[model samples]
Target: MADFLGSVWWMIVSLGVLVTFHEFGHFWVARRCGVKVLRFSVGFGRPLWTRRDRHGTEFVVALLPLGGYVRMLDEREGNVHPAERAHAFNNKPVWQRIAIVAAGPVANVILCLALLWAMFMVGRADYSATLGPVQGMAASANLHPGDRITDVDGRPVQSWAEASIALTLAAMDRRDARVDVLGPEGDDRHATLPLGQLPAGFAEQRVPELAGLSWGFQQRQAIVAEVSTGSPADGVLMPGDRILAVDGQSVDSADQVEPLIAALGRRGGPGMVEVQREEDRLALELTPRQDASAPGGWRVGVAMSAGTAPAYDVRAQYGPLAAVPAAIREAGRMTADTLGMMKRLVTGNASLKNVSGPVGIARAANASAKRGVDWFLYFLAALSLGLAILNFLPIPILDGGHLLYYLIELVKGSPLSDRVMIAGQYVGLALLAGLMGLAFYNDILGQLPR
Candidate 1:
């Protein structure tokens, strides 16, 4: 319940900030263009707080924090005094109207860029892909563990984060990605990993699920940070104890230990557990518990140390200007990746199981916030950029729809009929409703452990 509340709080704060900024953009631009903005709202539904400025624009904080809008005086919607007609949104020229409509999305993009720049200026810890022993299925292919990857597919890997990204992207292409590694033998060795196999739900059109499945290189260590009270590990494995191995498996790192515990279902234990505390080894017999949150019916009642694990070097800081371009490029890459994933979903190559609504977003927001301020800011920036892209999509009842109408007006030399406009709006609303419903459905389904 605490976790749920935290998620809600983070989601509200993050979304509210972004939405308010976005709406403010529209309000600012519209006012500048001599449009009479009636209401500038930070959210939907009844106003929780309201204030009227000297310009007579009613600024409001609404009940719902999901979204916001700027309402302008328009003659098409209602009766307008002859003197006020010139100040109405509809009376404005096409270019001015376009500018007003486009401002919201533009604001989101600017906010993202600013947040990213701040993030870099504040300086966050980043991993450098130094030599580490490789494990798992890829390890058997002559890629020895402890081979520091210097480059991937001709791209110089300045950091472990870059290497992880390269690995994931290379995996998507289903081709061998050349990785330059410094082997334990003190010699540089290049290994080509054939990463073609897609995960179980890779083709799922659901963005959240697909994003979750994209794994990266993680640090491996088995230090016990905390233990759940009354759980199997509590009173058995004390804090500061480094888990050595589970059963017969050689647990060299924390990563190896988790999967082993998860794999050892209820029946597999009463098993042998080995631990090292202060250079002292202790082996005890214990039965693993079942955690509903984790799959494969495996559980251990202990919190592990998080963030980037050992064996990776941390990178230095970046200047504000350098961070801006990097942030833009990153935003562009994320946008393209999102579009590609959407295409995959439409093509029936990706799963729809990953689609998430407000709930998922909130959960992710909370989780990211807990990770660090940098991560939280990064998430916000990404979401802001995504919102900008989505709002600009050619859909009715959206800014893009308004732009489309303007384009048609340019071609026909006249505005679209009110009837056509209303029809298009209804269609757009229905489409949006259906998509939201699907997203919510997916979100509910996601609550169940995979």
Candidate 2:
């Protein structure tokens, strides 16, 4: 219940702020263009809170927080006073109208960039591109655990994020990812990771996992971290005990210990465990316990003392002069990635599960909030970029649709017929409803236990 409420709160706050900013963009631009802004509202449906500004513009917060609008004085919509007819939205020049319509999404993009810039200045914790264990083809390719990935092709990667980006970019051509690494034994080597046959949207998903690398930055030692009371490890093991072997099988990493314990539990037998405690090698017999969550699952109820990953600073701590261009580039990259994903979705190459609705976004907000303020802001920045990208899609009933109409006007020297525009609106509404329905379906399905 607490988790549910927290998610709801964060979702409301996030959506409210974003929607207001978006509506404000239109409002500000319209006012500047000599258009009379009648009502500036955040959200749809009945107004929850409202106030009339001295300029006679009404400000409102409505019940439905899904979207917002800026109602302007338009001669076509209503009978405008003769004195204020010049200030009507319909009376404005086509360029001014375009600017007003375009400003909302542009503001979202600017906000996204600003958030990113702030996040960079504040800095966030990150880990180096170090590997733990190689498996299957990764081992065959001579990629070893404990090797630090220094570069992909010629591009240097100081952190995992950079490394993932580099690898994904390399995989774009459906070829191999050329990676340079420095081994634990002070040896330099290069490896080409095969990328062909990877699933669609692999760059956004699989590349980060490194495709069967089964690796971690810091090698996990076979030392016990903690033991849950009333469980198998409670009476048998203590923290700081270095696990040496299970049933005469030598254990190296912590990764090798669990499977042996699980097997013994499933077989319903005791296993001989050897551990080094304070320079003493002791042998003990222990039986694994059945996990309540999974009927057939086995557990020793001991947490592994996994060491912290090697650290790297991924933030761009740039000056004001440099931050703008950097932010712009970052925003542009996000835009391109979104468009790419959309293209893949249209081509049926990407999964619809990737489409997150309100539930997923709320969950994300709650998760990021737990991480820290910087992480929460980072999440918002990404969402903001998504908003900008989605709104700018050339679909009817969107800012892009208005822009398209303006372009048509520019070419053919007249506005699209109102009858045609109204028909387009109905079609656009249906399309949007279908898309939202899919998003909601995915969100609900995702929340359910698999």
Candidate 3:
């Protein structure tokens, strides 16, 4: 219940801030263009709070905190007195009208850049890009344990977060990526990861996991957390037992325990499992059984949690002056990535599951907030960038649609017919409804256990 309430509250807060800023952009530009701003509202429905400025513009905080709008005096919407004719939006020059219409998305872009700058200045906590083990594609690429990824496709990555994104994008494009790595022995090397080799039907949602890479610092200890009844380890292992070795081979992480257990099955024998129980070290013999459900067709039925994650091993930090350029670079990269993803979606190269609705957003907002201010700021920046991208899409009923109409007016020397515009509104509404339904469906589907 607390989590549900937190999600709702944060979602409201997030939308409120972003929507207000967007509306203010339109209001500000319209005023500068000599258009009479009639109302500046954050959210819709009945007004919860309202105030009128000296310029006769009404400022309203409405009941629903979902979205907002800036209403300007327009001859099209209502009558305009002769004295106020000059202040009507419809009377403005085409260029000024374009600026007023475009300002909302432009504001979101500016906000995105500013938020990224603040996040960098505050230092973003992240996990190191150091590898613990390599499997499948990663192993095929010759990545070794303790090797740290320094760069991907000529782009330097400071953390696992950056590398994962770079690799995931490559995966979506079915392209190989060149990487620079620093080995644990202090030697530098270069390799190409065959990210394109993943099956076409593979889910991009699990890209990082199936990419056969695991971060070194993130590996859990070999302590058992659970034992399934009637399984190989049920009678032999307890929850607190820390597995020290399998068949006399020392184990460092829980990931190491599985392979050794599988080996015991192939060898057709019960194996000596060495463990540390509190202050005492003991050895016990246990057989690994074949189970179709277990990895490598073997099972011991011992479960382990990553357990109280370690402190962040990396940070993306920049000084005040340096953060400006860093923010610009980050925003540019994000924009390109977003555009690429949209293209992929259109081309059916990406899944519809990537489309997150309000539920997904609320959960993300809450999670980021819990992580830290820097993380929360980063999340907001990314969201703002998405908003900018979404609104800029040349679809009907959006700012881009209005901009498109203005462009057509610029070329043909007049506005589109009112009939055509109304038809476009209906088309846009249908597209938006379909998209919202898909997003909500994905959100619900994501909640179910895989």
Candidate 4:
């Protein structure tokens, strides 16, 4: 329940801020174009709060936090005074209409760029490649246990975070990732290390959990958080028991135990497990259960504790004039990525599961917020850019759809019939409803524990 409420809170705050800014864009642009805005709303449904401005626009906070809009006076809705018709949305010139319609999305993009620029200015912590100490078995053969990595390929790395990203991207298609290390002397040594492959059936499969490799900046000691009732770990393992090993493998850390458990495939099989409680070392043999949530793995139903490790030696970068351009570029890339994902969804290459409604978005917002203000702001910027792109898509009921109508009028040298426009509105509404349903379904499914 607490988790649910937290997620809800996150959703409300994120959507509210985004929607308000978006609507304000339309309001500001309409006023500039001499159009009268009837209302500027922060949400839909019954008004929770309302204030009429000097311009006769009713500013409102509504019951729903899902979305908001700015309503402009238009002759299409009713008979308009001859003097006011010039300022009416429907009576505006085609180019002026397009400008007003495009303003909201433009505002979102501007906000995203600003947020990203702020994030860049504030400084972020990152790991150095030398942070992780090489373990016994993996370290023994070619690389020493304490060797600190200084470079990848030929690029000299000042910190481990930079080196790790370079190595991972390089290793994506290569069989081996070349590592340059700083030896005990002031000498540089190079090693061509073979990359680990996915175990048989898991190849070609993309699971969200295993998509990226975590550079071992921190080691977590495995302590049992909860023992599922009637599970294999229930009688054998209690809460607070620190896992030591599985089979004959030495598991000194939580990170070590995961790979061993995954390799063993212990579902429904008698498996040996070793754990330490206080000063006592205990061992037990039990059959692990198959967890349906874990698609290609066995589970003993244990939760491992983990947290982000601080990167103390990371370098900071900042430039007053250059940051703005960098921010714009970064925002543009994120916008492109978001559009690509949307394209995948429309093309049937991606599942509806990729769609996230309010619930899913809130969870993401909350989690990102916990990471840091910078991360939260970065997410907000990306989301803003995405919103701008989505609203501009050529769909009925959106700003793009209105632009489409204007374009059609331009081409035909006349406006569309009222009946035809009404039909288009219905179609647009239906499409939006379908999309909302899919997004909500995805969000609900995502909430189930994995």
lDDT of 2: 0.80
lDDT of 2 by residue, 333-438 (tens): 6776678778767866556777889999889999888877777877888888788777887778988877888878878888889998898888888888989999
Q: Per-residue lDDT for 12-52 in model 1, tens only?
A: 99999899889988998999999999999988999999999
Name the candidate that leads on lDDT: 3
User: How far off is residue 248 in model 1, in Å?
Assistant: 16
**Candidate 2, residue 414: lDDT:** 83
After TM-score superposition, the amount by which residue 412's alpha carbon in candidate 1 deviates from its true location, in angstroms, is: 2.7
C-alpha lDDT of candidate 3 relative to the true structure: 0.89
Q: Is candidate 1 or candidate 4 better by lDDT?
A: 1
TM-score of each: 0.76, 0.81, 0.86, 0.68
Worst 10 residues of 1 by lDDT: 206-215
The C-alpha stretches of model 4 lying farther than 4 A from their native spots are 126-212, 221-317
* Alpha-carbon runs more than 4 Å astray in model 1: 127-137, 150-166, 169-189, 197-251, 254-313
Arrange candidates by TM-score, descending.
Answer: 3, 2, 1, 4
Q: What lDDT does each candidate get?
A: 0.77, 0.80, 0.89, 0.72
As for lDDT, the candidate ahead, 1 or 2, is 2
Give the clashing pairs for model 4: 127-161, 128-160, 129-160
